[model samples]
Target: MSKSEDIVINWARRLQSLAQAGLTYSKEKFELERYQEIRDIAADMMAYKSDLPLAKVKDLFCNETGYQTPKIDTRAAVFQADKILLVQESDGRWALPGGWCEAELTVMENCIKEAKEEAGIDVTVEKVIALQDLQKHSSKIFPYGVLKVFFLCHKTGGHFQANSETIATDYFSLDNLPPLSVNKTCVEQIKLCFEAQADKNWQTRFE
Candidate 1:
């Protein structure tokens, strides 16, 4: 992320925290409105600095009331032969084809949907590969807390179809994987996923 993006994110988080604190501690409606106005200012700052539009910034920040929650991201580790499926994103980096979990779908279903949407392949989730808590790791990419759930999947059907989110899809050996999108998929997490695939006794490792 750029320096401007960092500033925008930090401002938004601070504003959100302020709003939550005000709502929880103060009973007056006027005070709540004041804090909400501050959040709106923070949203404006984000709109000025980030790629997101003003409406999107407002929806992401000011519209929320109390406590802010981290999003749940779902991914699948689909192995074919001895290689694993990876996607080349629009930014020209390879990453596991996955995204934020949708509200209406179960986690397993979301992982399947992401595989199709991002990699153009249908897959069945066999078992959870790993449940990683991003907050525990001191990483610059996921500074804002996130929970990543990786599932060990088997290819069911469908041809590889790359979409707008992904430019190409290919398989890679564990040691020869391309530069990955660290914010979305990290090397340690991928190793854990592959390890789970190799171990039958390791049911699921949640961290």
Candidate 2:
């Protein structure tokens, strides 16, 4: 996406966040109506900019009523020797084993759960590799902001099983990776994981 497109998405997300907060706190009828209008405008902007249906954009971006915050995603970087673990998604592209962090689970727990569910592996969370702003790494425009936490995990046990999210799982060398699901995981992130793994005193990287 172009810089101009990125700016439009940023503006829409900001308007949506403001409107969501207003809807959550303001009780006055006229003020509520105004907030709804702001939300509609935001939804429209998102729909047009993203080439999504207006109703779908509203459902994804405007349905939630709260003080909007960046969503947390947990990814596990599990390596064996020189190879890093990656799961082939249903779409046939690979990504690290992870997904949206559940509100009920701690970040580590969410990372563990995603590793088990997506790649069918048991892992011990070693340390955080990075805490990244998704927009900085991906060109994909989302309705809201996302903070992706990559945990360097060590595989303990377990074998791959049939799962809905991913079709297969395997370890791939850093220099020989398959096509990636960029929205979920990117080449730069994989490289950082390898760098962190090699350095015993690696500092946690953050955006």
147-197: candidate 1 lDDT, tens digit per residue: 889899999888876577999999988899899888788788778877887
lDDT of 1: 0.78
Q: Candidate 1 versus the native: TM-score?
A: 0.76
Instruction: Assess candidate 2 and give its TM-score to the true structure.
Output: 0.97
Provide the lDDT at 162 for model 2. Answer: 72
lDDT of 2 by residue, 1-207 (tens): 888988899899999999999999999999999999999999999998997899888888887867898889999999998999999988899999999999899999999999999999899999999999988887777887889999999989999997899999999999899999989999999999999999999999996
| Predicted structure with the largest TM-score when compared to the true one | 2
Per lDDT, the best of the predicted structures is 2
